[model samples]
Target: VHIIICFYSIVLLYPQKNMPQQSEAIVIYTGWERHALVGSDIRLSCSFFSWRWTSDDVTFSWSYRADGARDSIYVFHYTGGAPYVANKGPFRDRLEFVGNPGRRDGSILLKNLDYGDNGTFTCDAKNPPDIVGHASSVRLLVFEKVPIQAGVITGAIIGAVLGLLVLVVVIYYLMRFLVARRVFNLSVRSVSLCLGLRSKLQLILYGLAVTRCFFLI
Candidate 1:
């Protein structure tokens, strides 16, 4: 009777702990806003702001996708210094773990980023001993290189400038001719047409110059 009473009292006083409270896990990073050029390297950095939990049992993995496929584009698992390529098809060699996974640094570098390598990449943390944190995502934008023809852009600008100079010379000669023919009224329409043509030509040249600037960028 006494034992039964004590057991009942213990049960009432405290409930069994199925699981402990989850620890707070968060990822922090910066410098991922600007557009990444094609055939260049892209670094997806993931840093743990505050990892209060103690667990080496947790598995660190990274999943990435470029084409929004039904499945993960690529997945890497870090067991030790060597990362296991769990699901790497196209990004076999191009993908490299920048730092050790055992630490909080979860940055990854993808070398020679191709056109197909433009998409969002996700960093996942799973199976933590105490708390399970959600994955973080980074959007990647790849800029395509403009295909400029050999000398076509420069040629157009130079041609436009030369043509404008020639037109100006012709206009000056016509104005002088009209001034000498004091009885003749200068056709205002002709002057307006020449100015309009010059403006249009200058705009075209400016467009070409802008394209060149973009190419250089």
Candidate 2:
């Protein structure tokens, strides 16, 4: 009697490429110039582009220059199973991961922008050889509300300046018209004298000259 035994082997498969990828991307973190006024809820974003993606366990880090201290602002680690987020400080809820790891668009978004959140930001991915990117700054400027009285005063000043300009222009035009009319009246009188017209014609010309003068005045 001969006995035969059959056995089957099972193989597990995953994406072969599993390594920390190195990428470089830059984002306009500050989004505002120094001393510029900005409103609340302004968003802050940082990007990391144009870097190679290797199959190595990687960690992403965000840093800021505050009070002359280089602190770990936020950290994201990519283990084999799932992504892990390490809470650094102050950015527990304000930071958002805008890009997915496999896509390599490592960008972050920060919301509820505040004046205290102004400074230069340094972002990098922690692969074997650190892949670093830096933003000039990330500024959260606040716009102060204009006082009602101050606004009124400024409006009144501008109105007064415009009124003065208009008055000067009107006076200039009036002077020019008067000089032209005076010359014209002189000519009219000389012609009347040379022609020696009737009293009625002289009276009519005089009435017209008086009407023109009255309107000008």
Best TM-score among the predictions, by candidate number: 1
RMSD of model 1, in Å?
Answer: 23.7
Best by lDDT: 1
lDDT of 2 by residue, 41-133 (tens): 433443344345443555455565554466635444444535545576655566666655554444555556555666655555443344454
Q: Supply candidate 1's per-residue lDDT for 66.
A: 64
- Segments of candidate 2 deviating more than 4 angstroms: 1-39, 47-61, 67-72, 75-86, 97-108, 113-115, 123-135, 142-178, 197-217
Estimate the TM-score of every prediction. Answer: 0.49, 0.40
Q: What is the C-alpha lDDT of each candidate?
A: 0.68, 0.55
lDDT, residue 214, candidate 1: 100
Query: Which tens-of-lDDT digit does each residue in 1-217 have in candidate 1?
Result: 9999999998787755554646565554434443577889877776554455424654556777766666665557665445676544767788787854456666778788777776777776533543445577777777776455457899999999999999999999999987877544356667888999999999999999999999999
What's the TM for model 2?
0.40
Q: Pairing residues by index, what is the TM-score of model 1?
A: 0.49
Displacement of residue 156 (Cα, Å) in model 1 is 29
